[model samples]
Target: MTHDLLRLATAGSVDDGKSTLVGRLLYDTKSVLADQLDAVERVSRERGLDGADLALLTDGLRAEREQGITIDVAYRYFSTATRSYVLADTPGHVQYTRNMVTGASTAELALILVDARHGVVEQTRRHLAVTGLLGVRHVAVAVNKMDLVDWDRSRYDDIVADARALAARFDIEDVVAVPLSALLGDNVVERSAHTPWYDGPTLLEHLEAVPVGTDPATQPFRFPVQVVVRPQAGEYRDYRGYAGRITAGVVRVGDEVAVLPGGRTTRVVGIDLGRGDGTVTELSEAFAPQSVTLRLADDIDISRGDLLADPGRPGHVTRSVGGTVCVLSERPVRPRDRVLLRAGTRTVRAMVEEIIDQLDIDTVDYRRAPQELRLNDIGRVRVRLADDLPIDDYHELRRSGAFLLIDDADGATLAAGMADAPDRYAGADI
Candidate 1:
């Protein structure tokens, strides 16, 4: 039997031991192969180190190894007896903030690392703010390098307090802090005797046991049509089905659903799942994250960009959307900038209606009315779409509420945005 999976992301300031911590997790989990261990050991000796540098296990890029810093998002997979894990080790440099955003976008939990000596710094606050904005519900704070502080409980407590306070400001309530030295493998996978004062579960323990994913019953059904399945000549010749992955909630045969941007109501007559060999399996019901072709009772003109959702809980259909954005491109986003907004499988032409404010990451406050959003800048903006879009607040459903801004001319992605009300982050309550 397969265990449940947990998707997690790591964020921290430069040299906060994010990579080392991840490397330690992979190494201690026995996820590393003998050849990989040999390679890391060989490189450690080349650097005149006594033993294998675990950080080398994750710093895969040559530039990163040379600079001893993470430059890109490195994803590593490992499984314990309890659960499987997907770890996205993101870059911590200020310039690579975009990379961190990309890595943490789909994360169910965030593992934030902090240097015990520094406590809560500006980058920590920035990451926490992003975590909150992205709606990551759970957080695990790792107060790393406890050995460097001589395993001082007072110092560890101070850091954890400050980190907790910072996390609270971002509305991250489910937070757990662990004091450990990632380099020495203390309190990571194993309980370290060096820190006998700490009683909480180890980092890996928390990760394995943390509650993940949402209940389909509680969430409203959301299905973004990816493609219209219509075979010109086949056994299923007369069939017309909407093919896509269910983003949220559940749907069953005879359940009423409404296709959005049109608001046409219909009952799900059948749910079909394709077996790779041209054979299709029909299911009585389906839920979020499942890919299936749905046949509706009535043939509504649904296309790739349309949304089929619970009619009672159908999302907003509007030409305007306001939310926070994290600029990811080198090109700045200014008022009246034309861009493409891609939400799920749907992409639409959009314009930057206004730049509401720029977030001061250090202070966790907004600087009202910024002229332009440059690379790595997080701010609020209003966008006017050329066509009406069935948008939802990110807080409602993360998959449907998130969108990407692309440069209209060059087709380069400019920013990652979360759909929300304008006043959502207008105050310190953000």
Candidate 2:
């Protein structure tokens, strides 16, 4: 059996040891090379530190290394005997909250760190809120810096209680709280004898065992055509195929599908797995995340940016959508502002019809009628698209429900958007 791959993002306030925990996981897992270890040791000695600074493993930026803060999203990849892992270490600073959104958007799990000495702070709440908004189902709260608290069971328990309450406010269901000291490597990779009262899997163990969800075959099918392949000269000269990655569910030969926005029904005649060596293998079926070419029985008008979906449960087709958005660019977003909405492979012109409200991260309430949204502001906004779009509720179908707002002036990304109102905060205060 093939071990499944887990994608996770780590977030925390500045100095909460997010990088240290990631570095320790890599170090203890034997994923780091000898030269990397030697370099970390050299840097530690240069900085007058007694031990190797494991945080150096993920803090690759010079500014981060010198200033001792994560400024951008840093991705690290590693694998163990049982599973492969992709870790996104997000920035902790409030100003870089946009980076956190970018990192956590595609993650299946979120590793939230809390300083045991400081407990939960404003930034902690902000990150937690963002994680909830992104629809990340599973969360692991690492109560870090436990060594500073002398492994006090009461302190750990109190912190865990607080963290759980905060997570609950966001409707986060699966939460595992682990008390560990990233610097000392206690309860990170291996169980620490320092805490006999606590009985839970170590951080690494929890991550390895967490169940992401069912196979893509169980979900609704969604495919956004990225390229229409037509070969003119070859043994297969008449071959015409729609090539794209399956974003959700599965598609099999002879399965009936509908072209979205056009609502045209067709049957999948064949499937091809491109080997990228000028050859291809015919497939009986293909599922989510796989890049494959599909041939339809009817040569209906299909092109890039068109969606192919399960006809039985096609996605929503509409011109107006309301959801939460995190403004990323320095320029503010206001009513009547024209922007480009990129959802899946389709980019359409859209207008900001209304600024519903901005989220008060601290209170978990909506601040009514914000005139405009600035950088790092999370708010509910309604958009009017120039053309009808086939979209899904973000909570139900993440791939089909998410979108991005792009500035038309220079093609800069302005915000990351979701398809429906946040469940927890819907109708919150009008």
Candidate 3:
């Protein structure tokens, strides 16, 4: 059987060794090819460095290398014997917080790196808060560059305590701290004698052993129709199928479902696992993240932008929505600004009704009634849509509850949005 896949994102402040940590993980796991390592070694020697600059493995862009800092999200894929991994190496600069949000949106785990010598910083707290808001359930705090701090047990313990406290404030329960030297490859893929006092598992061990929670099949069924497949010149000329990926739960043949926004009920007659070669096979059931075609018994009016959901637990259909927004563009978002709201495959005109408040990252407090939201400002806003949408709470259904704000004029993405706050952030104190 194939091993399960774990999606994780790495976050930290600038010069916190995030790139080095990722490079070490890939290098020690023997995931890098000889040619790639040779290129890194060549660059390191040209720069008069003592060792191969492992950071080059992830800092691939020319601008990033010239500035000696990560500027964009770098994605790397690798695997171990027991588990597969998809790592998103996010930028550590404060200005790139929006990039961090994009990377953590679909991640199940977050690897937060802290410089052992500097301890926890403001950016650390901000990243933690964002992870919590994005519903990342697991966090692994890597106190990197332990060699610079002499691998002192006391120092490591202090940093771990600080991280744990901050995580608790965000209601993140599964947090593990490990002291390691990403440059020296200590306690990353293997345990090192430099940390004889440390008793916990190595970083790789923890990643392989961590539980990824329940199967997505157990959740409520949610499939957003991407396209209606109707081919006229095929052996199956009468075929009418709704093609899309199941965003949540399990959908099977003969199950009762309702098309959202229209509230029309129908039964799934068949499911087709379409192959690009004009051949298809029937499936009894399909689960989350699987791309397939669904056929209904009745010829109902279902099209792109419509959602198929379980009848008993349907999504909310409304024109108005209240949620938090992470502004990504230089232009400020103000009341009465017209924009395009894109959720799933649907995009509709929307108007900003009110800017409720802006969040203070330091105190986790809301600044009352901000006139507008600037770049990198996270604020709560109410929006009135041109049409009713079947949206769900982000806390309950992450895929269905999330959306993007687009500039209607130029088609530039303006912000990333979540439907509602988690229980922890909903409290008055937060």
Question: In order, how many clashes per candidate?
Answer: 0, 0, 0
lDDT of 1 by residue, 1-430 (tens): 5589999999999889988899899999999999999999999999899998999899999998888889899899998987999998998888988988989999999999999878888889889988998999999999998999999999999988888888888789999999999999999999999988999999999998899989999999999999898856876689899999999999999999998888889999999999989899999999999999999999768899999999998988888889989999999999999999999888999999999899998788888898899999999899999998997889989999999999989899999999994356566433
Q: Rank the candidates by lDDT, best first.
A: 2, 1, 3
Q: Model 2 residue 270 lDDT?
A: 98
RMSD of each: 1.8, 1.7, 2.0
What is the C-alpha lDDT profile of model 2 across 1-430, one tens digit per residue?
Answer: 5688899999999999999999999999999999999999999999999999999999989998999988999889888888899999999999999999999999999999999999988888898899999999999999999999899889989888888888899899999999999999999999999989989999999988998655897799999999998867877799999999999999999999999989999999999998969789999999999999999999889989899999998978888888889999999999999999999999999999999999998887888888999999999899999998888899888899999999988999999999883343565656
Candidate 2 regions with alpha-carbon error over 4 angstroms: 421-429
Candidate 3 lDDT (Cα, 0 to 1): 0.91
* RMSD value for candidate 1: 1.8
Identify the runs in model 3 with alpha carbons over 4 angstroms from their true place.
421-430
Which ten-residue region of model 3 has the weakest summed lDDT?
A: 421-430
Per-candidate TM equals: 0.97, 0.97, 0.96
